[model samples]
Target: MEYTELKVWKETRLLVNNVYDVTKAFPKDETYGLTSQIRRCVVSIPSNIAEGCGRRTPKDSIHFFHISRGSLYELETQLYLALDQNYIQEKEHKVLLDQIIGCKKLLNGFINYYKTLKTKQTINH
Candidate 1:
């Protein structure tokens, strides 16, 4: 399946777009610091998903999914830092954080399902 057609990838792409929009209002001083870090983490989400889908094995796909989840956590941390530093307001922080959490949950579900399918195939074989 095309990565773009996957529910997890679609939601992740939305999360990344939301992150980009929120970061646009950050202080100019953070351009090289929080801003860059946040962008990279957000980008990693769907990038990892796409890379995983291109792989030859389900194991490789699961590995990339885990990496993407790590990036999701990284983005979540930076988002909280942005809120604590007053770079983002409480409402904005809550909205983006909720989206990040949703993406993580969806990714986790996808990973579990993929792993289960792989295991079942191995057992059958």
Candidate 2:
């Protein structure tokens, strides 16, 4: 299946764009600091998912999914830091947090699905 068709991937793709839009207003001093870090994590979420989908085995796919999930968590922490630094308002933080939470749920579900496939493959062999 195409990674683009996955809900987790679609959600993460939206997140990346949203983050980029929000980060544009960040202080110029952070252009290569927090801003760059945040953007990288956001991009990794969907990029890793696409890479995972291209893997030849469910196990390999899951490794990438875990990496994607890790990036999601990392992004969450960065968003909180943005809030602490006043780079984003509470409302903006909440919106981004909500999106990240939703993506986490979808990504966890996707990972579980892949784990099941790996288990089934092992059982059948």
Candidate 3:
């Protein structure tokens, strides 16, 4: 299946939208600071997933997936920073956290699936 069709990728895409929507209310001064950083981290999640899917080998795919997972964690931290800075409300922060948790679970499963394929390929060879 195309990476875009994957549940994790789809959910991450939604997260990108939700983040963009929320960040719009952030201070104008943060436009190039936290805002930009958050945007990049969120975009990386799905972009890396797509890149991984395009890779020829399972190991190569897993590498990109790992990067995506790392970005998700980074984004999670940034969300907390946003909350502490009062850039977002507790309710909004909770929603984003929940979405991140869901994406993490799905991405972890996807990574494991690739790892199994890698193991099988190694055994077959």
Candidate 4:
């Protein structure tokens, strides 16, 4: 399946875009610190999903999804830090946080479904 066709991938892409847009307005002093960390974590969301999808096994896909989840948490933490540092307003922070949470839900759903499929295949075989 194409990466674009996956709901989790699509949502993750959107979330990453949102993070980029918000981080663009971050304070100039944060160029090498919070900004960099936040960008990397945001990028990891879709990157992991694509990497997992390219793998030969469902277990690999699930592993990448788990990694993506860890990145999502990292992004969330950075977002909160940005808010606390006054880099982003509460409203913008909340919106981005909501998107992150949504993407996480989608990723978890995909992981669960993939695991279920793997289990069924094992049982049938």
Candidate 5:
């Protein structure tokens, strides 16, 4: 199963791209601050998802999913900070935020699905 085939992964990838694009316009002074932190957190979301897809066991994969979820929340907080700092305009903030929220929901759904699968596997084994 290719990671790109997962909707959650694909959506997170888009979110990461948006983060990179917007952070490009941030003040140079924040180059090593919020900008760097945001880039790392957003990248973690999809990167973890992809890594999870390659894990040898369902349980192992789910661990990566949890990591990805944590990264998403971190990204959200950083985005809010960016908004408060006026690094991004309201319109840009809204669009990026909406995307982040949607991606988070999708990640949650996938996590639940995988947990259920692991439970069923345990019961049968």
Candidate 6:
């Protein structure tokens, strides 16, 4: 399946866009610090998913999905840090948190679905 067609990818893609929009108001000093870190982490979530979908083997694809999950966790942490540092307002933080939570659930469902298929393939082999 094309990664672009997947709801998980689409949602994560929106999350990335939101991150970019929200991070713009951060302090200038954070441009190379918290801002860059958050951007990298958020970007990886969707990029990894797309990369995984391009892989020929199910195992390879699943591995990328795992990486994508890790990135999501990293982004979640960064969002909290952003809140604590006052880079984002409470409402903005809540919005981003909601988006991240939704993306994580969708990504988890996709990963579980692929894992089940992998298990069935292993059994049939």
* Number of the predicted model whose lDDT against the real structure is largest: 3
**Candidate 3 residue runs with Cα over 4 Å from true position:** none
| Residue 12 CA displacement from its true place in model 3, Å | 0.6
lDDT values for all models: 0.91, 0.95, 0.96, 0.91, 0.91, 0.93
Candidate 1 per-residue C-alpha lDDT over 8-115 given as tens digits, one digit per residue, 9 for 90 to 100: 999999998988998999999999999999999899999999998888878888999999999999998988899899999999998988898889899999999889
Clash pairs of candidate 6? none
- Could you give candidate 5's per-residue lDDT for residues 6-109 as a string of tens digits? 89999999998988999999999999999999998899999999998898777998999999999888888888899999999989988998998899899889
What are the runs in model 4 whose C-alpha is more than 4 Å off? none
> How well does model 3 score by local distance difference test?
0.96
Worst 10 residues of 2 by lDDT: 1-10
lDDT of 2 by residue, 1-125 (tens): 67788888999999999999999999999999999999989999999999999999999999999999999899999999999999999998999999999999999999999999999999999
Provide TM-scores for the models.
0.95, 0.98, 0.99, 0.95, 0.95, 0.96
State which candidate has the highest TM-score. 3
Per-candidate clashes come to 0, 0, 0, 0, 0, 0
Positional deviation of residue 89's Cα in model 6 after best superposition, in angstroms: 0.5
Kindly give the stretch of ten consecutive residues in candidate 3 with the minimal lDDT sum: 1-10
Candidate 2 local distance difference test against the native = 0.95
**lDDT (Cα, 0-100) at 55 in candidate 1:** 84
Q: Per-residue lDDT of 56-107 in model 3, one digit per residue for the tens?
A: 9999999999999999999999999999999999999999999999999999
Distance from true location, Cα of 107 in model 1, Å: 0.4
